[model samples]
Target: MRSVAITGTRATGHRPPDEYGAIFSAYLRPFADGHFYIGGAKGIDSLALLWLAGNSAAHLTVVVPGTVLHQPTEAQQAIARTRERIQDVVELGAAELDTPAYHARNRWMVDHASMTIGFPHADEPEGGTWQTLNYTAEQGKPRLIVPV
Candidate 1:
């Protein structure tokens, strides 16, 4: 089982079909049933979690920045419910209403995983996704970029 960390923009507002397709094609295809570590958040993270939950992979871990229950968002709540079924979700810190120390949380994700798959070009100013990718690169970690 190869553990790969997934990250991306939460506000890119560009959830194109190809992006999800690429995730399955480029990342999930090569690995066996239970071999991915999904860093959970909104947008891309939620999508990845939902896909894996239905696919029946028992090794999926949803890593969140804070208490998953308190992370308020319709998509997040829905994902959280599905995530409970998976049984490997982890939270890194106390509950945060906003994105407090979120970038640091991203860095933690990158540091722990062997590789990171993300959408670094989906947004501007190099947000959490970019920081994570950059951190992984500096540490000589591998990366697979998802389409925007």
Candidate 2:
């Protein structure tokens, strides 16, 4: 199965706001059968996880900087409840959870996927999302940006 990596900003909240939800839903509709790889972070990552749990038939793999317990409470709960639906949960070694850990996780996702979907702020234009998309470009992977 093809895999699509999801990378985005952490500013969207646990549940995406209305506008973001619309964009996210639209962007994900075509990937119903694709495997989703996401960093188990607080904002966009958790929002994507919840969206997939409710809308898509795709398998999900959450790549974490540390243990699942290290994720935001909302993400942890969602993963626990939907454990059966998820295909895999990858936890990085403890030493990898520092400032650069999120970048590492992003690279892991990008390396494993065929394409990447990103939600980035055009104004701010910098963060993990930007870094991941840059990596995706360097790897010559296709990218779909959902402007937020």
Candidate 3:
């Protein structure tokens, strides 16, 4: 499987829906032919999951740092909205939902996938998103960096 791990920011309110649609179309469409490992968070994760669910036939996996119920209501709702289309929901079952737990989740995805694509907020540089990208690079895999 051509697995791709997608890591991005949770803040996407700056762009309109149409703009994000176009961005996904241009950057994510080509990679949508295979399986995807997406963090089950708000913003890019939820957006890309919905887009791929509707627009492609790829297998989708949503990986959460903890149980789905532990996530924010919005994230849980997003997963619920597209439950039928998702192929897997991986809950790492971390006791505490913190930065390290999230970083561990990101590392898990990178370890499972061959490539990574990150959509970081333009101004932001350090976080789980960037850490994921760095791990991907450390693995000597291809990485597509797109700042939104």
Best by TM-score, which number?
Answer: 3
The residue-level lDDT of candidate 3 at 139 comes to: 94
Tell me which of candidates 1 and 2 scores higher on lDDT: 2
Candidate 3 worst ten-residue window by lDDT: 121-130
What local distance difference test score does each model get? 0.68, 0.84, 0.93
Model 2: per-residue Cα lDDT at residue 67: 87
Tens digit of per-residue lDDT, candidate 2, span 96-117:
5676887888899999999999
Candidate 1 per-residue lDDT, tens place, 1-148, comes to 5667778766635657556766665666665354566666677777666766665554677676776765548456756568566566667875554555676677777776788888655446567777788888998998887656
Error of 3 at 74 (Å): 1.5
TM-score of 2: 0.90
- Global Cα lDDT for candidate 2: 0.84
- Give the distance in Å from residue 83's predicted Cα in candidate 1 to where it truly belongs: 3.0
Give per-model CA RMSD. 2.8, 2.0, 0.7
Off by over 4 Å in 3: none
TM-score of each: 0.79, 0.90, 0.98
Clashing residue pairs for model 2: none
lDDT of 3 by residue, 45-69 (tens): 9898888888889999999999999
